[model samples]
Target: MECERKYRSRALYKACMRAFDTLPVCALVDSRFLCMHGGLSPNIRIISDIEKLDRFVETPDSGPLCDLLWSDPSENFDDIDDQQPEFKPNNVRGCAHFFSYYACRDFLLRNNLVSIIRGHEVQKNGVRFFRKSSRTKFPVLISLFSAPNYCDTYNNIAAILKIDDHQQLSVVNIEAHAHPFVLPNFENGFQFGERFVLYHVTNLLLSIFNMYSPEELAAEDGRHDKTGVELLNKKRLIGTMDRAYAELKKINKITLNLRGLTPSYSAYKELLTRPEIKALVNEAEKGRITSFDQAIQLDHIFERRPHT
Candidate 1:
């Protein structure tokens, strides 16, 4: 509600909500394929069973409705045998069940359906086909993801499923097109203004501090001698400040490069674990690697070398 008030009109928000209210949770196409946002529910054995669900209210935390919205196809479908149960608790998601190949096969056979089409998981090629068995003529389940370059980081292809009158399925793949870059986290005008003010204020204070000469600083310290130990100490302090400023600039550049290359904090930490990256970090700490470009070149050299 806060986000809607900030960026969208109340009327538009209401219209969108009304449209969602009318949309069906699942669809049967050509009386052969079942299409839904997520996979099947353990409680729903037939198509009529889904039709009888009370979907008008908010989806409950657990039950047939929640499972229909949140359940996923099991990753170990190939390993599942005929004797194993069709559905198991989804440990990864912690709410719904994981439907295996056997479950999907049983559902299709029970409903007199050819295939189940769902869109709960992202696919690298935008589509995935799961066969019921090694000798099955057609895939029992088809997972289609129409978002290319998902989250602007996965570099995945988008695809659409085309079902002809004969019930034959074909996939059309699409590559991500170039688009204008935007800052992450949907930064608002107020946030940008705050950052601008803080940056300038910090720079202004640093400039004022740097304006003081060594002699002036020593004088301010109540040391009147021009060539005394106080003057030497002040000189050393100035040199230390210069070194610190240089190091800060280098760190800022590296941080920008890392942000551009790594999409998330987990990925950044994983990159740090690489031997080349670790070596670069050690050099950076010792003030040896001064630029991100130098670090990139060293990383490339490590990439080209064969592993022992």
Candidate 2:
């Protein structure tokens, strides 16, 4: 019976990974295994402890960024078109990881799961879809962007998606448009001067950063010269992964600083380990969470009972 059970367990593990790898964008996202950029809100009382910070920066198996960049497409680079070219921007304005990581956001939108949310990227012109993976390719995008003048000051706006009582989806894809201002050539209320102005300023800064001498802005093989990034070998890359995991599992329950520390738990651990009773607690805590919810989860951490 033991040998047979082992055989079945091994086979089941392989099947789960295979299913996970090929799961459709819809299904992968719909699984409610989620990730995002921004830290959870009620944005008051920011955590200051170093141990707690690790919970914020988890791996794909444990971190938020991995959900965006889990599938390498082919190689492990989730980088977007690196530099800002007019009308074309990198996958993310600041970080390229979102090409794969944003997949989680896409998943959230299509399924209408409210618990998963991210904050780093701005929502200029609202949540625009990438051509390569739109709703047509991956039809649910929770949305992206969070600030004004993001990605070279192109779209300056905020967004909100409303699901009414009737179950109808109302998408606030953009802020209020100019009613009095209209122009056919500009394609909207925005004029030529304001649109390209930010783009030009970015280019000018890049030119200064790259220029070796007068009469030449550094261009590599007719492309913008990439800023230097410290190259890492395969070993270094793998080591970072190990470090992320180790930091996450470090025990803290009996520590002296429990009183001084802001009480919180790891989303990454709960998601990966599937800890007993967490599924119910995590589900219940979904949608905007509060400190009360945090206290409830804290109660479930390694309960040791009385034997008296």
- CA shift of 52, model 1, Å: 0.6
**Which stretch of 10 consecutive residues in model 1 shows the poorest summed lDDT?**
299-308
lDDT by residue (1-308, candidate 1, tens digit) is: 53465566788777777778678989998888899987888899998998898887766767888788778888777664677778888765566788988888888888888888899776778999886644356788888999886545456689998878787778999998988654433435475355445555555655665687755765665766754456556556655655555544444444433322322335445656778766765564454443435544433422211221
Off by over 4 Å in 1: 1-7, 133-136, 193-308
TM-score of each: 0.66, 0.24
- Positional deviation of 67 in candidate 2, in angstroms? 6.1
User: RMSD to the native, candidate 1?
Assistant: 9.9
> Which candidate achieves the best lDDT against the true structure?
1
Candidate 2 lDDT, tens digit per residue, 1-308? 22234454766776666665543221123333233343321111221221233323323232323323321111222235334221211232221222332443343454444334334433445554332333334322244554433322133466655556775545564453434422212222243333344445544544444444322333324544442211113224444544543343232211111221112345335433655444533433342222433433443332211110
Give the whole-model CA lDDT for all candidates, comma-separated.
Answer: 0.68, 0.34
